[model samples]
Target: MIRIVIVDDHPVVRDGLRGMFDGDDRFTVLGEAGDGREALAVTEAVTPDVILMDLRMPVLDGVSTIRELRSRGSSARVLVLTTYDTDSDVLPAIKAGATGYLLKDTPREDLFRAVLAAHRGESVLSPAVAGRLMGQLRSPAKEPLSHREIEVLTLIARGCTNRETAGRLFISEATVKTHLLHAYAKLGVRDRASAVATAIEQGLIRRD
Candidate 1:
């Protein structure tokens, strides 16, 4: 049996996933967590073969959790099951070490197959997510923004000035400007406004 852990902030979602997996003879629901922090604890205790992770949560988010899991040398395969399919969500999760990315709207049978594939260490991606990744990969001119670049752009999108962003990120103002310049070049934008717009358009940042 493939031991599994369900991690999501919603109780209904968690319960539903548990119910679905519990009836399957090939899988077992080892435990559940409401947030990424709890997920770390539960995963460590249970040592599950696979983890179904949700992106947004009250405490630590899914991408950060995945990175932490990898840094800690946990071999459990992470399969992201979230409502978000945007580049901001999908790319970071995959980069952080998710074995698969699937939208919450995915069919039950498909999700089951995805989990099985993930347990075998195969990469799994929903059709829509796969398409998005392909588009990104095909666009040679559109390079991915670095983590710091995204942070700077996110702050700028929120109307923060370079100095303010630097203070918030605890970096020097010059460093903030450097990140902005890098982001602008990667996004093929000439200025902050255009860069922010392009990043949002490309789903690199959430639009508020």
Candidate 2:
């Protein structure tokens, strides 16, 4: 049997998932967590074969938790079972080491098959997710902002001035200004306000 741990903030969702998996002979529900922090604790204690993770939660989000799990050398494969399938949500989770991505709307049998595939170290993607990834590949790729540029914009969004941002980043104000200019050019915005707004809209930065 494939040992599993369910990680979702909603108790109702967790209970429903547990009920579904409990009846299956091929799988066993090891435990459940309401958020990513709890997920870490539960996974460590149970050492389950697969983790069913939700993206958005109260304490820590799924992608960050997955990264933490990898950093700690846990070999449990993570299968994303969330309602979101946007590029921002999907790309980061996959990059952070999720074995599969499945929307909450997936059929019960399909979800079971996905869990099995994930346990076997196979990459799984829902049809909509696959199509979105393909569409992104076929479209004209916009110049992505660099890490420094994003940092600068994120600080600016948080109401940091150039000097303040530079001080926080341990750089000169001129360097911060340069990063901002680059970010503006890449985002096709003319000013700081517009750049921040555009970045937030494009999911490049979190909205404060």
Distance from true position, residue 24, model 2, in Å?
Answer: 0.8
With a 3 Å backbone cut-off (N, CA, C), the pairs that clash in candidate 2 are none
Residue 41, model 2: lDDT of 99
Off by over 4 Å in 1: 143-197, 201-208
- How accurate locally, in lDDT, is each candidate? 0.94, 0.94
lDDT of 1 by residue, 1-208 (tens): 9999999999999999999999999999999999999999999999999999999998899999999999999999999999988778898999999999999999999999999999999999999999989987897866679988998999999999999999999999999999988888888889999999889967778898
In model 1, the Cα lDDT at residue 207 comes to: 90
Candidate 2 per-residue C-alpha lDDT over 46-143 given as tens digits, one digit per residue, 9 for 90 to 100:
99999999999989999999999999999999999999887888989999999999999999999999999999999999999889889878988789
Record all residue pairs in model 1 with backbone atoms less than 3 Å apart, i.e. clashing.
none
